[model samples]
Target: MSARHIILCINVGSSSCKFALYSVSGGAESIVAEGVADRIGSSGGKIRVRDANGRSIAESDRDLARPQVAVDALFDEFERLKLPRLDVVGHRIVHGGAHHVAPEIVTPALIADLKRLIAFAPLHMPGGIEGVEAVAARHPKLPQVACFDTAFHRGMPERAERFPLPRELWDAGVRRYGFHGISYEYIMQALGADVPTRLIIAHLGNGASMAAVENGRPLDTTMGFTPAGGFMMGTRPGDLDPGVILYLLEQKGYDAAQLSRLVNLKSGLLGVSGLSSDVKTLLDARGSNANAAMAVEMFCYQIKKAIGALAAALGGLDMLVFTGGIGEHAAAVRAEACQGLAHLGLAIDPRRNDSNQDTISAADSRCRVRVIPTNENLMVARHAARLVFPAG
Candidate 1:
């Protein structure tokens, strides 16, 4: 029998760090443990862990105020639980820019390259980098791989990759580099043999974006340049007019810092509704609060429009998938987004959709609408395993 190898997949978000441990031997794999350090840098933060069968292994309050602290806490829990030593680590890096496309073993050069690209994803890169550095500090010789979220979109055609800017700017790495690529890649893997010829995946979550895939190749995506570009998200006002930014700077005396805060933090559902950034929160209050109602409407409206645009990009739509936190759970959002798309032969059975079934499409609908839960952690682990344990 071959030896089992444990892989730790680390996904560092803006406010949380999620880690999963997978045990792989021979041709099989299973999750041995998983946990998340939530509300990092906030009061009342907690780190929770669970075993393979979803049993709580540990739960405790801690001052997880930074990525390094959270990483140390998780490693400490692993020791307390006496878990097997990890063979490798995988990290979900949000941006790879135009250089680091494929999954690569983390190195000093790679770290330096990532640091240079931090300006492209200022809010996310630091946490990812911190996670990597913290892991290195704890397990000096342990192999770590960086699985880029922008890698899946590297095959996009030049027309789709280019921005309507000066050639010099495009050459200087100013172009559409899609995000949520790890999720999209997982969705495609989950489809396996049944993958469609023309598909659009709407990974709706706190951060939302859509990708148009044709014959398993990425054609285009909603997010351009950064994660903040796609559509309206929980906090980001996606695809804002450049003139609005110019006006804010030239007329309103808004500096770069203030503009970044407004566009990335203060806008979107929370800005529009003057409420929480959570979709469920807005949904619950939509009936009573006009602003909340408008916010929901706007979210759905943008999604519907993006579907049409992506569908056109694919020449047609064979399957429409919804995956992510909001995509998998929020039935109302799905229904509203697909409401007026009958012209594209898309219709959802209300009951199936409300139940959050795997296949929510109406039988007669030409486009197959599905709700597939995305597992980006698993994808990162797979890439790490492939790179680190090639013979396994």
Candidate 2:
């Protein structure tokens, strides 16, 4: 366990297998290689592989119509590079359900248990589970770890985790289990003790959510029961009223599956703007399209509202960190979000925001705001190595 070991961390994106090879030794890690097999299940699949120096060594197009196919393509590319022998594998498992609150060794029994929770995270689990199984099948004896995205929020109080549903439903595992643990873990590690005691992390991507943390521990998060419950995503409605759901099914004669698709796929900014889900596209069209302008306004409005609500939950916000796709580069969105939040002593410096500094808030701003990129793949690798080779 003390010797240098190579770990491959596979993060199962919606349509890609993102992997990074890390060399871990003496309690430190260095990147060995990284890249992705993208466009899975599509005809125009692409693969890109890079070496430790961050240079692309292999790039090609192939049929990545399945997880196995995509993974196999990655391996074929890696073979030419002749990387170190893999010691173990780590998977970015999105939902671990009730049983796993930390990184766990992957086993057949555990896989079975994990698949049972797929219905809870329908959009995320199937693809992730497929990637995990495909890797295990390829290397039967290779030690593997399942790092749960829900593990970070497991420490949240019952009051925060529980829904107001019936006791029976709660017992049946219908409760809030926030995601993005891997990203939050890396962010906390990077921030170290300098991180404020009360903090909020806004991970704004196509699939977005926010986390309220106290002393580096998650207290509450926007996502609940499923990823679909969180903030308005690219295509999913956030925090919808139950009455609307009942109305959709009972009055409109929509079935359960159809209702699920409505919220999970056809709603959100796409539904409102009748255009692309990408925020940049919406921003570009805002000047010309009324619907796109309204969509942008709503998106920022929702983020501002969530910041206020989370600040209230934390008693007050000391530091606000933004990550993910939209949180990192969308300065206009950031400005729009912080426009009315100056009342909370959160001021966005226009120059700093535009420049993309690590700290985007004004020097005198009471609540500091930062832009810290997330490294969930590295988090997965660390977790996998720890579980694969436990401390004495």
Candidate 3:
């Protein structure tokens, strides 16, 4: 009998830290426990933990004023619950930059490299780096691995990877490094033997992007250079014309910080609607609120346009996948996006789509459309297991 190894996967977001414990043994894996420390650095912060069976093991409001505090609370909950010892820790790192394309054991050198690349992902990298540091401070001896979200697209062709910039810029690592790679990888694994030759995955959520994959490999992706460069998101205006930025700098007198704040925080659905960034909230109010309606329409339009573009990139479409928060649950959004895509041989069965079925495409449609829930934490755990127990 093979010994079981416990792996803890950590994903640090802007205002939350989600974690899960997975037990892997003899080529099988199962969740042991999972939890989140949310509203960090804000009032009414809370941490909640639950067992594998969905029973609440611990839940309480605490002053999670910092990432360190959240990390401490998570460890405390584990100890209080008397959970199995963690053999390894894994992190979902947003950007691996030019190098670090694979999961690697955490080290001072790796930490230093990540810190340098923080400029590449200002809103995301800090939390990930802080998570690593916090884990090191609490349990220095435990091994931690980083699974990058950009690693899955590292194999993209140069035409897809390169920006239409000067040679110096491309040489300086200023090229397309798509995000949501961990989620895409998980979707591919979930597809298993059914994986198609031409695939397009639309990971729609607050931070949305699409990828064109050919025969289990990435050909191109919607996002470029940074997460903010994709389709419009919950709080971002993706793929703005350079002229707009130049005008903002020259005429509006906006500085780099101000531009970053505008594009990364103020824009997107929230900016357009002048309301909440939550898609459900906007969708519910779209009937009465014109701004809300426009926001939702714009989002769906972008999704539709990207589908066409990616299908062209792949020369054709075999399968289309919808994952992430909006992709999995928003039936209306899916319908609107695929409204006129029959030309691509894609047709959504209204009944199946409304019910949120796994395979929602019509039987006669040549392109198979699926809704597969993404498990990035599980992907992270698997990467950690591979790095830690290579033979297993």
lDDT values for all models = 0.94, 0.88, 0.94
lDDT of 2 by residue, 87-148 (tens): 99999999988779999998899999988998888878888888878877778898889999
Candidate 1 lDDT score at position 219: 95
Residue 21, candidate 1: alpha-carbon lDDT: 98
Better TM-score candidate (1, 2): 1
**How badly does each model clash, as a count of residue pairs?**
0, 0, 0
Worst 10-residue lDDT window for candidate 1 reads 23-32
lDDT of 1 at 332: 99
TM per candidate comes to 0.97, 0.95, 0.98
Candidate 2 Cα misplacement greater than 4 A, ranges: none
Q: What's the lDDT of the predicted structure labeled candidate 2?
A: 0.88
**Residue pairs in collision within model 2:** none
* Model 1 lDDT per residue over 216-273, tens place: 9999999999888989999899998899999999999999899889989999988999
User: Model 3: how far is 54 from its true place, Å?
Assistant: 2.3
In angstroms, the error of model 1 at 301 is 0.4
Residue 223 of model 1 has an lDDT of 96
The per-prediction CA RMSD against the true structure, in angstroms, equals 1.2, 1.8, 1.1
